[model samples]
Target: MNKLSLFYLLVMVALIQISVPAITVYQNEMVLYKGSEFLFKTIPLDPSDPFRGKYVTLRFEEEEFETLDTSLWQRNESVYILIDKGVDGFARVKRLSRKPMSGNSNYFKGRIKSFYLADGKAIISLDFPFKRYYMKESKAPRAEAAFERALRDSGQQTFAVTHIKNGKSVLVDVKIGEISLKDVVSESKND
Candidate 1:
């Protein structure tokens, strides 16, 4: 092939490679900046992977929904969960949908973890996309300890602030009451 043609081919390949990550970053940034915010009640645990470094794993209290619809749901199948705030201002699942909700942006994409029938209703459990909150390595251990303490203390509340837009969600922060987890850890260290 001619040198000019080879150069053009390489350029095209490079552009394609760059565009993939660029689009993903752009979408995440848009959600973080312009999406609707919601607070999710969480149960957190700290775990570390050698390759990925340290992060806190977050499990939501509102992962299950009860419905009368008995349609078969396959594990790992993509689903949409509509969300609305509870009286306490934490997010709750409004409903489950096979497809994205039309004209509503307060929903997020999730996977079907499992489902079962109890009494007269079908209970659906969902796997949310934003499960991991990565933190600086130095702060992770302290954060984990703080999370554990907060979980044990009946007076403290731990929740995640998330932003959602167009079926995508970003985990903005993990906080104990009104203070960020990082700040909580730092304050505890100073005491």
Candidate 2:
């Protein structure tokens, strides 16, 4: 190829690389059990950014993981979450633990907190990195509908938030509280 063409190609490739979101592996490679459930005790947080829109941020309290064999598991690796909760209470998630509960003195009780699956990452939903996920008004119709359906079926507000198994994210479901999300858009309209 000509030098000018080669330079242009290189620039295009560089820009593409820079623009893509970098995949961050979980500090502890763990996979959540597919049929398990969760109930996180939400620790209230302050408003983040306008771009994020609105959502009731959370810190998970109960993370019920699928019982898996020690051999199939990996330490600190991320696994896909499945099955959201219903109004009755409880959300099911994939069993993804940092390390096996084997030989540990502490019991992996239902009180297990600080873990969630969103945006293709296994998040602990802590102070430092896990951030509120919000979506544009135009996108919420489908996203909210699916979320609502899952919530209805489970009879709980707790989410069975799952990651894309194929690793190709056509639509990343940004969780926004129904009330909070409505308020943000409605207030703007009234104004």
- Top candidate when judged by TM-score against the true structure: 1
Where does model 1 exceed 4 Å of error? none
In model 2, how large is the Cα lDDT of residue 17?
A: 79
Q: How many residue pairs clash in all the candidates, one count each?
A: 0, 30
TM-score of 1: 0.92
Error of 1 at 39 (Å): 0.6
TM-score of each candidate?
0.92, 0.33
lDDT of model 2 at position 7 = 100
lDDT of 2: 0.37
Q: How close is candidate 2 to the true structure, as a TM-score?
A: 0.33
Give the lDDT of residue 92 in candidate 1.
89
Candidate 1 per-residue lDDT, tens place, 55-116, comes to: 99999888877788877788889999899889989998988888888998999999999988
